[model samples]
Target: MSFIRLATPLRSAVPRTAYRRLSTQTTPEKKSNNTALYFLGAGIAGISGYIYLTGSATAKVKATNTESPLDPKSFKDFKLKEIIPYNHNTARFVFELPNNEAALLPVASCLVVRSPEDLPEDDPRALKDSKGKPVIRPYTPVSQPDEPGVLTLLVKKYDNGVASKYIHELKVGDKLAFKGPLPKYLYKANEFEEVALIGGGSGITPLYQILTHALPDPANKTKFTLIFANLTEEDILLREEFDDLKKKYSDKFDVVYALDKPKEDWKGETGHLTGEVLKKYLAKPELGEKVKVFICGPPGQVNAIAGKKDGYQQGPLGGILKELGYKEDQVYKF
Candidate 1:
């Protein structure tokens, strides 16, 4: 029942639905129509017939002075090299950086993707207060950060998901504004004796990022146990990749699958992550911070992990973590 303050990124990384908007101030009316306004995700790049964006939602990048070419502050334009369809609702966006760009992707970072064009007027995801703004979303890359030459995102398409839908519709060769190496978590080798990775659906991306970084390093003996939840067999993403990693690092990694709608032959656990389920799978709190838990999923799952109304302000922890006697620092919500 102890309440501990969560980290800044963990508190702010709450999944924002497309319809939720940031607090916006009204722009002053200008008599001229051709005036250029600068905002995150507001720049455009004209391709052969289609146009993609080449701007950052975090800040405007100056080509003259940049800390590093790969830095998010130095937002760079990339071209979509390939699209691999994973299932009916998800596609992998493989974007390629210039040959000279930094290929090492920092562990557990993200990218801000902005569509060049705004959605139709009647679309629910279209900007409400900031009508002139384009749709954007933060996504974790599926490709290992150091995997040279390309950037890949395993995105799940939602009917009303603005960025996800737009990305799903993109063809190979289309370009988009990709600005980031937005580091969410700073991980060290064997920082924790044991860690639990809990994720659902598309939230599995970050968990995968951490998995790839930790399991393969022979120097890092951090043991990982992942509990991934999905609606059905079709919704389970990166199954092959996770399986491969588990086999490669047999002693260090293990994965558990949870399904909501199982077929007749389904043989694993099912339903949402209840306290009892967590008690059985999650590491006990005896070692304090030495044992850690990371969670990423839709709103409901995040709320359950971080606590209902318990973020930034350091409110009391709730849900399974609270029920399990885990401290706030011991659990991170992504």
Candidate 2:
């Protein structure tokens, strides 16, 4: 949001007297001095030109180096920089970027990650899966798209979950192969009057990505309502960040946390998110295209809410959202 303005350099001017002296001088000594002066001037001009060209080339190299580290077409290995524990099962993993640069990820996109052991045959020690393929999974980063120097992923360890377990076990200096900027639905300001984000567990991340990208824009007029379901209060990921957003963008954003098993002092809803619960908070289906619903979570939760995703494609509408009269186009599964 800030810009640096470079001041223009002042051009040096030659004295009229110096030109007159050169024109009037007839002595060989004066002519020789003038010739020496001309040579000196040429040398200075050559040095200046060389410096300018070198500086321009340096600037171009710097620009190229600052480009986003993740490539959409190929997998690149990024070394782990730091890890911060979030809860009993979840942690935030930070990976170093080669140069100081932002992730520059598009809004609502994710990266595909796989273990280094799953890399190509060039590595003699590479491990092969029993299924004869690498275990790859897509994950949305909780960090902002423009966060520089590193990209961070909020991961939760799931029992027998290959990708999650691998991420959880990563040490600070280890590396992971990542490929993406995998495009999802790119949101524009005021594209919809209302957006209902329904998610469970780590599913809140993509929803978080959307809201963070949207609400911060001065032109954003859309209202967002998030219904996040978790096992308990402790299971809610990015709770503080969402709460801060609600406080800062009160008119444009709000969130409802649903805990399956809440503590005695908890005041939020305590039950699995159901169709009835959704109906109460979501925009009326009659609003049609003005309203949009996004669903992401564990397979069961997503299926119960808006039907299962058929691999990379969205499956048929068959769940609570369908019963509630939400059309296929009005809902998206991530």
Alpha-carbon TM-score of each model against the true structure = 0.73, 0.78
Name the runs in model 1 displaced over 4 angstroms. Answer: 1-69, 100-102, 116-132, 308-316
**Cα lDDT over the full model 2:** 0.83
* lDDT per residue (tens digit) for residues 51-160 in model 2: 69787424433223446778899888889999999999999999987776778888889999887634564453333345655667899998877766788999999987
Residue 41 displacement in candidate 2 (angstroms):
46
TM-score of 1: 0.73
Could you report the Cα RMSD, in angstroms, for every candidate shown?
23.6, 11.3
- Which residue pairs clash within candidate 2? none
By summed lDDT, the worst window of 10 consecutive residues in model 1 runs over 40-49
